[model samples]
Every structure is written in C-alpha cells, then in structure tokens.
Target: MHKVIIKYVLIGVLAATALTSPVRAEAVVPLTVQQFFEVCQPTRVTDFVDDNDYIQFGLCMGVIVGLSSLMDLNCQLDRNDTPNHLKADLSGGNTSLTAYRQTMWNYSNDNPSLRSFPVGMLAASLAEEWPCIEPL
Candidate 1:
C-alpha cells in the first residue's frame, strides 16, 4: 500500500541555518538522534510500575505525525520553507508515517552518535532519498 512519506530535501543537512539557531538554543534537545533511539529501542522493564516504553514510543511517533501534518499544511500554503518535503517514494509517491519512522529507526541503529541537534539527523536519514542536487 502506498502512503505519504516525508521526503526531506536537506539543503544544509549539517549546517545550522537562521531557522535552526533559535530553535537549537531554546530547545533542550527537543529532537535528537539519541532520543529517537531511546524511544524506538526502549529497554524492556518487567517492573509493571516502571514500564513506560509504550508511552515513549507513542510520544515519539506522535511528534513525527504532527510534523507530517504540518508539512502537509505547508504544502497547501505553497511554502516549502523548511528542509522537509513530503512524498511517497524516492520520487515522491505515497507518503506514510511508518516509512519515516522506519527510516529513523534504521538510521539511528548504524550511526549511534548522541547529537542533540534539531532534526539534523532526521534530515540526514532522508538526504540520500531526496537530495537537493545542483546542476553542474
């Protein structure tokens, strides 16, 4: 089944832009690769009183869903201001939250760096898929 996936055209996947500076400063690492990893790969606790893996997983996915909705809204405004782009496939087909979640899940497993930056790693995960190429 085809669904809408976030296709990120990270113009500056690594560089902090005018938009990300204030966000990075105000954020106590609101979204980071480390947090994603923790949420996606939470430790199983037998202690019923302390079990919160499901909660964290829900919250993490919720954020991504919210972001996806916002991206969709922005598209209506015809303003692709952010590095985020939405599509179905590598060529922008049917977008799905599972696709983005899976991409983040798979990407974090390999590069286990605790970079507490604003969605920089998120952009990186989709960079190879939707790169902002310049004609030579």
Candidate 2:
C-alpha cells in the first residue's frame, strides 16, 4: 500500500509539472506590411470620423503596431536587421489579439499623452495612402 501510494503521488507531481510547462508555437501567418495596412486603415478612419470610437481605435492600433514591431525584431523578420532574442522573455508565449491589446494598454500607460484621437487619425491616413509594395 505504501509503495502504491508513493507511485500515485509521483505520477501526480509529474502530471502537474507537465501541465504547467510552457509551450511555444509558431505564428499562424507572418505579419506582412500589406496585412498591417489593411487592418489599420479602416480602424483608423472609423476612429477619426467617429468621436466615440477614436480613443479605442487609436490605442488598439498603437498596440498592434507595437506588437508587430516587437515580433518582427524578435523573429528577425525585418529586412534590415538580423534576428535576435530580444523577445526571449516571450519565448513559449501565446500570441493573440488580446495579448496585443494588453501590451498596447501598457504602452499607452507609459506614454499618457498618446491619446486615441490623433493617433487613430494618423494611422488611418497612413494606411489609406501608403502602398504596400512588398509581396506577402
């Protein structure tokens, strides 16, 4: 009975550790400049024209840009720079829109003056005018 109990306890401990272990998964689609523009354009415009949506949209875009930049740097996806482990902390981390938004909120908090209205308008304009020459 003692040996059986010990085996069960060991099994439980191992199972718990396995469950808690972090897993890293590759990004589903590499974020392209074209996709970035496509996602940002409408959101920016809607925020600009509508006072109600401006703040939310602006903050959202800021976060998206921020995350993309970070991912690009970490993954060495940028054309100019060599890839590095700048995002070592985020290793085995989950990637999703909610995570991006949270990161944006943190960024906004650090820079309080970066309000939604202006940022949103600017992002909208950039998205609208900029042509993504890069092939996805």
Range of the 10 consecutive residues with the lowest summed lDDT in candidate 1: 1-10
**Candidate 2 lDDT score at position 129:** 25
Q: For model 2, where is the 10-residue window of minimal lDDT?
A: 23-32
In order, what lDDT does every prediction score? Answer: 0.51, 0.41
lDDT string for model 1 (47-126, tens) is 32432444455566676665455544444444445444432123245756667667766777777664465554564555
- Residue ranges of candidate 1 with Cα displaced over 4 Å: 1-30, 42-51, 80-95, 110-114, 120-136
Candidate 2 segments exceeding 4 Å error: 1-70, 78-92, 113-136
TM-score for every candidate vs. truth? 0.45, 0.27
TM-score (C-alpha) between model 1 and the true structure: 0.45
